[model samples]
Target chain A: METSTRVPNPFAKRVIVVDWGTTSLRCMLVEPDGEIARETESSRGIRFIADRAFEPELMNALSSWFDEFGNLPVIALGMITSRNGWIEVPYVRCPATASDLADGIIQRRLPNGADLYFLPGITDTTRQPFPDVMRGEETQILGFGLDKEATIVLPGTHSKWAKVGQNRILGFQTFVTGEIFALMSEHSFIAKAAAKSEGIDWESYDRGVRVAENATAGDAAFLTQLFSVRTGMLANELKSEEMQDYVSGLLIGLEFRQARDCGWMKAGDSVGIVGNDGLNDRYRRAAAIFDLVTVDGGEHAAIAGALEIFASVKARSDAA
Target chain B: METSTRVPNPFAKRVIVVDWGTTSLRCMLVEPDGEIARETESSRGIRFIADRAFEPELMNALSSWFDEFGNLPVIALGMITSRNGWIEVPYVRCPATASDLADGIIQRRLPNGADLYFLPGITDTTRQPFPDVMRGEETQILGFGLDKEATIVLPGTHSKWAKVGQNRILGFQTFVTGEIFALMSEHSFIAKAAAKSEGIDWESYDRGVRVAENATAGDAAFLTQLFSVRTGMLANELKSEEMQDYVSGLLIGLEFRQARDCGWMKAGDSVGIVGNDGLNDRYRRAAAIFDLVTVDGGEHAAIAGALEIFASVKARSDAA
Candidate 1:
């Protein structure tokens, strides 16, 4: 039952791991070996912090921690490192490793004597027609570990299907499934007709998945399959309560089918599902439908990743 | 230089054909032989008409016409016949002719002593997992003429790809490409980031089409390709001005690809692009890129179809 490799606090020297994104800010105090001590989150995301008041706002939120423990080194990831955030950090190209990511971190010293580091997102130049890129997710993938050679899926607004092998993060592709699902369910005529329901309609959802998986004529008949959501209702096959989940299942199922076509994964292969987007259960079920075994990734992957990458940066600097 | 089979008013007994949808109402007065005499459109679609004021609102809008024509028969189609609309008209099964549609009409007498006929939409029970249905497009396909055995593409919020032959609509499928495009460009992150620019960037749109057409991998990589619209921007391969048209081309292109996969039509085959959704030129261009010959459908196909079906109804009633 006690399986975690997290190190216990001895001297209790703390570091802050912040996953600051567009809509919210999540901060965690962790031990040197990545065991979280305390965590706090707020709506004071980059979007809300007007006139570059990020420092005062952040300090105000963590004033107690700073007062109790003095200045702690901070490592921040996510959209806060993008062009629109606190500082623009260049992306490290894949096939990347902890060291490669460490090399890409841009750092600054705060007025409170704390060192703040912003980790670089990653880009895949090998992608066809154009390079595919991901911010923040690269760190999450890093935190999920790269010892095993397997495909990993980090589901989000923009889901990433990545390959990890040889201690390096290989290339990945993005699927805008979540955003499409949101738009369709909230705005589309077929999906808008659904009466708000209390729970998931698993049967309807599975039916949608089945349609996507069995669409052998072209696994890419997404738009056509999308219309089936409406047709199903008109035919009295799908109830109004079932429309939302049905659309969800259909889009996610199509994502999996398309991912397989891109050689991301295949039937009988195991895939690691990372991220805590509340969509893991859906993806796991989808993976089961595709005959893919699910690998449980650690929930604190972001914290672990930031710590690992920052340590690598410190180690390289000390060695130099 | 002018050649039209449309009969000019020879004792023109006008019949009003109203395509009353969720967002707009389009009414056309046609001669007994189907030449459009006058047309009027308003935003008073089914969704806008409150408290069943449909009768009064319609009467008020067409009072002048009724005063002149002395109680003309009004044929109604589109969402106005749905469960949420004025009347719920059941859909006629596919492999149906004009007479079959005529037999399915649900008629009621208006307060003005005019017969109001609601034309039945068509349903393809053969569609997998559920029956596929269309409201107005079936009438348009009829207007396009069932004499020529050809595949017709009606572009709209929910576009329809229908097959016509042997004086009947054999079968058809629906693709929500327009809806998806609207959702993406208006709501999705990658698409919303594009600067609002006037006019279509044909080059960008064509590039998107090329991606869909030449996708060696799964053609249903729609979600994946949707991300490419964003990736193309991040990679500097596509300018902000080009994003809208590019996404438009990509979705429409994929629709054509999927339709071909579904055996709707093939390269070198002539396909008719019907409907006046302001998207025919784009569809025609996409059709050309797919090596299909574009057939020009009559501009007033709905009026013609409504008139023809009504005539069949009158004949059947007289025979009975």
Candidate 2:
């Protein structure tokens, strides 16, 4: 059924949203109503253009796209505004809202007179001992209209579990689970312990989760178990995939426990996943152990969030 | 003050002792008195010859070395006898002597009429429910005369802490400390935290040792502190070398604590290091914390171990 009327393309001027990530760059052209019109992407990520500043290369790439539709209003998110990116937008302490991000500095010039707005990353100060910072995902979280309280999990090389409240990032923690697993599997002696496997072994992974959850040895000491995987394999006790799954389960499970210990999420708290299908499934499975519900965090939410921030900025500018 | 000893003529019959490692090959021509007459080496190691049987490439390399001399009794050690090598000598459970290894197997006419004796790796049965194996180091341990009673620390990619008593390996445990440090420094996010320092920071290393010794986090979890190094550096709380030392100390210190926990060594135990100099020093410093005395595990010990094994084998063959 029809829910609401679509806003006229008052910004028929078109709003451009860019999700500049580590490995890929994605740009979406949106009408005033936040409906995607034309989308373009490239292999140009932070890694490819890291040696240079973000603007010229990004402008050159986007200029080609914008040549078709002249002088569009562009809003950029992600690592592009990081210290190494096109512009360094300072981190806004979390529990932040779209208004807070919309209030961040907007780069108005490309040295060539191209107007651009960069979103400031969010940091959660509620974490007493220290604070956690997030860049692009803040836009996505804001996009999710998670305007109220919720738990968000962004799984990747460094998986982040964050708590958001009232458009502000309450707090967050990062886990090097993916990076550790890759390192051990490819470089460490544990590689000797694992065989190439086609799929995950739930039992082994579950066992690993249990071990990680109940580990009495300190974290630094538990690394010794890495060798045990190989030893177990050599002894014919564990299959290869089981070994791999155990490794993954151990890491993810530990991260799960750590997040819980940090008081980031409760047993009944809802968790939202902002990642791909495989990672989402893994998080769901892990979160299920704690009986947590998860919501979808797809591209649409990110675009919605960016557009909301844009609308707020336009409103404030018009008011001023 | 002169000790009576047997001195073989420089031109006397020579025995070729082959030390084949994972990366390099070294052949030593020894006199009856166990002194080196000639030494030659090649870049051929197990990794380079992994696809080929150990005998042909090894025999070719030895023949080139022996082209200088004539036929000689050839004794080989190291990865040459691993499952992928020339021959796979099954492990002989420890409480074993040099004679046990020497008399284990002899691979004859290996691509040539060269009489080759393959050393059997040693294994420990003392650890209940499992056993550990060692291939090349058995000869070195024997050469050190450590068969009777002693504690040996063989540092490498996988450092082995072993206890020998009454001519048998009482027990041993493996610590992947070196490899873990390497992986953490090079591959893991911890590398981002560490200041790339060329030299060692003893103080920071010591501090890391203390932290690892008293680690409270679980194994994979303690890695979270790695970010603290970067944070600490950015916050001006620590220097680059200090970060390196901290990481190094944590890994080594954790290993030390684990070895101690495993009852691998006692406070008053004499620890003999059988590896390279740098690792030996690190181990010595770590051992110092526990008041354990350490001795040099030099090339002489390895040679002596090989020669001792040879003598034991000769004696056993004579008995047979």
Candidate 3:
């Protein structure tokens, strides 16, 4: 198995990588050695482009980036290929390696006759025997060099808690705790029952977590406990921010307990957080309650993962 | 004390009863003896008709019926008088008798010059430090003659479990369990993951009740249990109907357990169910798990309640 130290660049040799997300689209011009030359981003993510047919607009936006690279091979890894995006690629089962996504698909045609590829999302199957879906986060997990084995926590509206091993997603679970909290705080009757506040109250958050942790079979029956938030406000007992934090803690704490019970994560498992800074911090603090170690997953992981796929595609084209 | 028994004209002294709900509006023309003459219903409920705008449409709908009764005084109950309905009548604390609502608002003019009275909903302050809300069911409890000290269970989207004594609604609690179960089983992510079928599977429903009843802190993760619905479906060990029933049992069972913990009901206390037949049957089955006796809530509770209110108004007017 002699490997070539000098990788051959198949035609134009340059590679274009795109990280198309829910809110924005980012394209990177990469050199053969995995170094960034020029990076440009567009606001045309799946959300913006979802209402219209995606393929034409995507090809048009992507063409300019390729033209700058002199018609180089382009590879995309993100939500761009989701059901609601430019194309829909079926999710590949976990225990997958970087090589598995090396041969994905690009649904659009280019004028310069450039080769294109898209990475498939990851899925997991384990004890519960259900599947978990991930688009852009797959790139970050790959970038974390978690190609071997690790637990990754992707926090968002619908948080994804996953187990990764041997470059494969072993299993995962999704929790709507964030969305539930948001809806309840903003739209549900609980909002009226909760005391109005303006700042984060750590004490309320702690109290909420304790309540969630000790919630018995009938605890949910007392959802009217939400009314206490308002009563507390009227009585000048709980600050507004504390009420908000308490609500957040209740939702997050419930999610955390559920995740643990589902065996989504075990004690002593190394957990990596991939999300925005503020959310990551909150999650980190919450994770401390369970004594779990947290790792930073900056935007670099996404770029690296995209570049890895781009390089693989270029290498394959050259070999063919 | 001297009592005079007088029979009002069946046609000229007809009573108008209105049962306005979230999604529909219903009106009935009743003879002096409470016999139904003509009934009319419409899609104009609080969900569609704004609180301030309901009066006009209601008057228009009942114009012909009122003509048949030669301008009989209409008594409106149910949601029409709720905070979100035609008139925002204040809640009268429970342990309330039929006479309480009967003494509520009287003689208001609809836009069409029709005279009407709105029944006040019941509020249970005895549970205070915590209070609960009841709209149309207050009339039904009065109709069922449960006002003289008994427990009443109203099963629907927001199931109302109440304790009444001496014509007063003593204490009560509302469980959003039905609404939660519907949302999770039909619109939420769980619906997508689990199978959907018709009818209840006793085994799966029983299993759900057991889990909800006895799940330990370490074993009570909803996410994990939710996923099992899918796995059970895939494994051909559970039916779609079973999944729905299981979710229902879990939620309702949890509510029942919580209500018990909150001291809303005692172990030996009699329970009366008010609702349609199906809902009452479900409550009966669930209550049987706890060895509690269930009684019928009678079909005429809503109408009877309205009649009781009307009778009170008549007595007050005569006294004046």
For model 2, residues B10-125, the per-residue Cα lDDT tens digits are 22357787888767788887876778777877888887875675666766777766677667778788877776577778877767766676667666655556677777777764
Better of 1 and 2 by TM-score: 1
Per-residue CA lDDT of model 3 for B1-320, tens digit only, reads 11111224223367787888877888888777776778888888787875467767776888787666567777787777765677777777766766777666645876656577788887765442235577777777676664356777788766777777765766676776665565566565444556666566777777666655565543344544444554455445666657787777766766666677666666666677777626666677777775677777666667666676666766777799
Chain B of candidate 3 vs. true chain B, TM = 0.83
Best first by DockQ, ranked: 1, 2, 3
**Candidate 1, A1-320: lDDT as tens digits:** 11133433222368887889988899888876568879998888787788978788777877788888789888889988987789889989999998999889898987788888889999998876677889898877877787779799999889999999898998888899899888988888768787777777788777777788887673346777888777778777888888888888998898898898889999999998888879988898899999999987768777767766766766777798
lDDT of each: 0.83, 0.68, 0.65
The best candidate by lDDT is 1
Give the alpha carbon lDDT tens digit for every residue of A1-320 in model 3. 11112222333356777778877877777666666677887788777774666656656876766656567767777777776666677777676666676655554546567756777887665443234456777776666554556677777766777777766556666666665565567655434456666656677786766555565543343444444444345445656557778777766766766676666666566678776525666676666665577776664666566665555666777788
Docking class of 3: incorrect
Candidate 2 C-alpha lDDT tens digits along A1-320: 11122233335467788888767888888876668888888989886885675777778767865788777777888878876577778887666766778778567765545578888888655432234466787766666555567788887777777777765666676676787778888877556557667766778777766655554433323445555565555556667667788777767776777676556576777888776426666677777776677776764666766766776777888899
The better-scoring model by TM-score among 2 and 3 is: 2
How far out, in Å, is residue B122 in model 2? 4.6
**How far in Å is the alpha carbon of B187 misplaced in model 2?**
6.0
Among these predictions, the greatest DockQ belongs to 1
